[model samples]
Target chain A: MKARVHIMLKTGVLDPQGEAVRHALGSLGFDGVNAVRQGKVIELDLADGTDEATVNEMCERLLANTVIESYKVEIL
Target chain B: MKARVHIMLKTGVLDPQGEAVRHALGSLGFDGVNAVRQGKVIELDLADGTDEATVNEMCERLLANTVIESYKVEIL
Candidate 1:
């Protein structure tokens, strides 16, 4: 089984990399761009029998830094 | 209103950063870690009237590369 996790900053957090991308996009002719914030995704191929609780635990334990970000998991 | 976008590589795509992170985790004493794939999350603080279709279009056009990645949007 496979799972996809998305980790992102909470609102009001600063995102330097996304800002850089936004600037880069403007230089590359992407107009009307207002704002950008960057986050992370993690995909996992888990052993069979792995359950959602374990996955959520993983997110809280190591996969995500709860201080600045939150995470969502999608099973695929 | 705010929307969060997650961008990630499709299955079968290579993820150098995730591999690097896995290695780093191993060195940091995170055992039993088998695999990792990295992706991106974007947060959008949109105007009052922006719709989901437009947000998705943004994902396809500039927020994500369809050639290598897919995206999801969340409203908060």
Candidate 2:
């Protein structure tokens, strides 16, 4: 089984990296890019029969920085 | 409207950041975490009624490093 997890800063949190990227985009001639919020993607391949609870545990334990980022997981 | 884009390196690509993260996890007492692949998450808040085609164009033109990362978008 494979799972994809997305981790992102919560709303109202500061994102300096994202701001830097936005500035770069403007320098590269992309207009109207109002904002950028950078985040992380994690791909996991697990043994068969892994439950959603286990996946959540993985996020809580290792996959996310919960103080700043929240995560969503999709199993396939 | 909002769209979430996930960008990741294709399988077999080197991911040094993920490797570092995995090592950190081990040092922090996580067990059985064999591998980690790092990628990016982008959140776009667009005006209502934005189409997927436009989103795709934004990604193709700037949001991804097409040489290495592939992206998937989900609208909400």
Candidate 3:
């Protein structure tokens, strides 16, 4: 089984990397890019039948910094 | 309109970050975590009706390192 965790900055959190990417896009002549938020995706290949609860626990424990980020887990 | 781009390394490429994370997880006592691949997700808030072609071009030009990575674009 596979589990994918997407971790993203929380709303109102400052994202300098995302801002830099947005500026780079403007300089590259791509217009109308209103906002950009950069996040991380962790793809985990686990033993079969690894339950969702464990994956969620992984997210809560290590995959995300809950102080300023949120995460979602998807089983595939 | 919004667009989400998921960029991931091509198979066979060495991902030191992913490996480090895996090792860290093992040390943290999370067993059965066979493999992990780390990637980036870029969420774009765009002008209404911003077409997919434009978003794809952004991926080719700036969002992804085409040499060692592949990207998927999702419009929302």
In terms of lDDT, the best-performing candidate is 3
Q: Indicate whether candidate 2 or candidate 3 has the larger lDDT.
A: 3
Error of 2 at B7 (Å): 0.7
True contacts kept of 3: 0.92
* lDDT tens digits, residue span A4-67, model 1: 8878787788888888867865676645557877878787776676677777877887788899
In CAPRI terms, model 3 is classed as: high
> lDDT by residue for model 3 over B10-30, one digit each (tens)?
999999999988888888888
> Candidate 3, residues A1-76: lDDT per residue as tens digits?
9999999999999999999999999999988999999999999999897899999888888889999999999999
Candidate 1 per-residue lDDT over residues B2-76, each given as its tens digit? 778878888888888889877866676645558888888777766667788777877776788999887888877
For model 1, what is the alpha-carbon lDDT of residue A41? 78
TM-score of each: 0.66, 0.77, 0.98
Candidate 2 structure quality by residue, lDDT tens digits, B1-76: 7778888887787989888877876787655556778899887766677788877877788888788888999887
**Can you rank all candidates by DockQ, best first?**
3, 2, 1
Which wins on lDDT, candidate 1 or candidate 3? 3
Judge the docking of candidate 1 as incorrect, acceptable, medium or high.
acceptable
Question: Model 1 chain B — which ten-residue stretch has the worst lDDT?
Answer: B24-33
